[model samples]
Structure formats: structure tokens, C-alpha cells
Target: MVDDDDLILEVAQMSLEVVGGWEVTTANGARDGLVRARAEHPDAIVLDVMMPGMDGPTAAQALKADPETADIPIVLLTAKVQSADRDRFADLPVAGVLAKPFDPMRLPAELGSLLGWT
Candidate 1:
């Protein structure tokens, strides 16, 4: 998972670890997340939309544009839940989206369904 907010990261980590039973690696920013993604080649990525430098869309675009990482599933987490905002991501190679203030308890199942893992 990658997010600028420290609390979100911590909470997400705990939820995924304890409830989802998944070993998660987190990054504070897009750059670090990309680096880790390349190294770890994780099954999926949960990315925050708004960040200081590279936002989720841009990072996702970069990841998709790269042949090495293009196939990795990406899930965008955003506070922008507007219809238009959701439509804007239609063309991107994203696996799914989760609205902000999400239910941590259901996150793993939601992502798994999106990624077609279940």
C-alpha cells in the first residue's frame, strides 16, 4: 500500500495483516512505492489518489506504461467519489477503486474481488 498519510498507512497495514492475513509492505510516497513495487512485484497495489508529488493517477499511469509492471493490478483509493472523477479513471489500467473513509474490515475482500482472486 502507498499513501501520504501516516495514519492511513498504519491502519491499512493493521487491517490487512490481522483481518486479511496478508503481509503488506507500505510506502510513504509514490516514488518509494514504485521502487518497492519493482522490487517486490506484489500481487496488487493499493494507492492513494492525492499525494504531495506524484498522485495516484500519474503513478498508476507510469506503472501501466512500463512493460515490466504493466500487468500488476492497481487499486486507487480516493476521497473524490464524484461520478465524473470515477469516470476519469475508466481508461486507466486500474483494477478497481475504493472511496475514502473505507471500511477497513472489508478492504481485503473488496480488493480480492476486484482483482479476481476470489
Candidate 2:
């Protein structure tokens, strides 16, 4: 998982670990996320959209562009709720998008559903 916010990363990791029984690794920004993804080859990546430096879609594009991590499904988590905010991601290849302030209790299920992990 990748997000700039420490609290969000902690919450997401805790939620997924407890609720989904999954192991998680986190990155604070997109550049690290991309590098980590390539190295770890995780089952799926849950990325935050508004991160500094490389933003989620750009990172996702980079991951998709690379041969190593190209097939990993990416699910975006964003605070972008407006049509305009959301439309910016329409052209990206993402498994799904989940709104921010997401219920921590529901996050695991959401991730499982979005990535077909369940």
C-alpha cells in the first residue's frame, strides 16, 4: 500500500492485516511505491491518488509500463469525489477507486472485492 499520510497507512495496514489476514508493506510516496512494487511483486497495490512527487496514476502508469510489475492490479484510494476529480483517473488502468475517509472496518473487504482477492 502507498500513501503520504502516516495515519492512513497505519490504519490501512492494520485493517487489512486484522480483517483480511494479509501481510502488507507500505510506501509514503509514489516513487517508493513503484520501486517497492517492482521489488516485492505484491498481489495488489492500494495506492493513494493525491501523493506528492509522482501521484498515483502516474506511478500506476510507470508500473504498467514496466515489464516486471505490469500485471499487478492497482486500486486507487482518493479524496477526489467530484466528477472532475474522478474523471482524471478514467484513462488510467486501475482495478478500482475507493473514496478517502474510507471506513477502516470496511477497507479489507473493499480491497478484496476490488482486486478479486477473496
Candidate 3:
């Protein structure tokens, strides 16, 4: 997971781990997320849209550009629920978008559905 907010990171991590029963790792921002993603090679990445240093789409571009990280599925986490903002994300080759303030209990279902994971 990648998000600048500590609370959000913590909540998301717990949601994915506890409710989803999945192994979870976290990065504070986009740059670290890239470095860590390269090293860990997670099956999927949950990235925040607005962050310092590098935003989610920018980081996703870098990941898509690199052969090493290209295959991993990326799901954007965004507060921008407006149709225009959602349309913007649709242009990117991302798996899906999760609205901000997502429900912890529903995270697993949301992620699973997006990645087509049973």
C-alpha cells in the first residue's frame, strides 16, 4: 500500500490484513512505494492518488514503464469521486479505483473484484 497519511496507511493495512487475511506491506509515499514494490514484488499495489514527491498516477507510470514492475496490478485509491476525476483515471491502465474513506470490511471484496481474484 502507498499513501502519505499515516492513519490511512494504517487503516488500509489493517483492513487488507485483518479482514482480507492477506499479507500486507506499506510505503509512505510514491518513491518509497516504487523502491519497495521492486524489492517485494507484491501481487498488487494499492496507491493513493494525491501524495508528495510523486503522485499515484506518476508512480504508476514509472511502474508501467519498468519491466520489473510492469506486470503487477495497480489499484488507485482516490478521494476524487467526481466523474471528471474518475474519467481521468480511466485513461490509465490501472485495474480499478477505490474511493477514499473506504470501508475496512469491504476492502477485501473490492480488491478481489477488481483483480478478478476469487
Candidate 4:
């Protein structure tokens, strides 16, 4: 997961680890997240839309542009919950979006569904 907020990252990490039984690595910003994602190649990425240096859409584009990371699924998590915002991501190579202030309890399930994980 990549988020500027440490609290969100921590909560997501805990939820995915404890509840989802998944190994998670978190980065505080989009740049770091991209670096980590490149190195680690996680099963799925949960990215925040707003961040310092390289927002989620731009980062997602870069990741998709790269053949090595192109197949990895990206799920955007953001507060930009507008109709246009949803439409903006329609053509992007994202798996889905999860709105901000999400229920921590259901995050794992949401991600699982998005990634088609059983």
C-alpha cells in the first residue's frame, strides 16, 4: 500500500496481514511506492490518488507502461469520489478503486474481490 498518511498505511498493513493473511509492504509516497513495487512486485498494489511527487494516476501509467510491471494489478484508494474521477480512471490499466475513509474490516475482502483472489 502507498499513502502519505502513516496511520492509513499502518492500518492497511495490519488489516491485510492479520485478517487477509497476506504479506504487505507499504510506502509513504508515490515515488517510494513505485520503487518498492518495482523491486518487490507485490501481488496487488493499493495506491492513494493524492501524494507528493507522482500522483496515483501518473504512477499507474508509468507502471503500466513498463512491461515488467504491466501485468500487476493496481487498485486506487482515494478521497476523489466524484463521477468524473471514476470516469477518468476508466481507461487506465487499474483493477479498480476503493474510496477513501474505507471500512478497514472490509478492505481485505474488497481487494480480494478486485484481484479475483479466492
Worst 10 residues of 3 by lDDT: 92-101
Candidate 4 Cα misplacement greater than 4 A, ranges: none
Q: What TM-score would every model get versus the actual structure?
A: 0.96, 0.95, 0.98, 0.95
Candidate 2 wrong stretches, greater than 4 Å:
none
Give each model's whole-structure lDDT: 0.91, 0.91, 0.95, 0.90
Count of clashes in candidate 3 = 0
For model 4, residues 9-62, the per-residue Cα lDDT tens digits are: 999999999998899999999889888888999888999998888899998998
* Number of the candidate with higher lDDT, 3 or 4: 3
TM-score of 1: 0.96
Clashing pairs in 3: none
> Model 1, 88: alpha-carbon shift in Å?
0.6
- Looking at model 4, the pairs that clash are none
* Candidate 2 residue-wise lDDT, 22-67, digit = tens: 9999999999998899899999999899988889989999999999
Q: Give the winner by TM-score.
A: 3
lDDT score, candidate 1:
0.91
For model 1, how does the per-residue alpha-carbon lDDT over 1-118 read when each residue is reduced to its tens digit?
A: 9999999999999988988899999999999999998898988899999999999999999888878788889999999989999999887789889888978999878778888987
Which residue pairs show collisions in model 2?
none
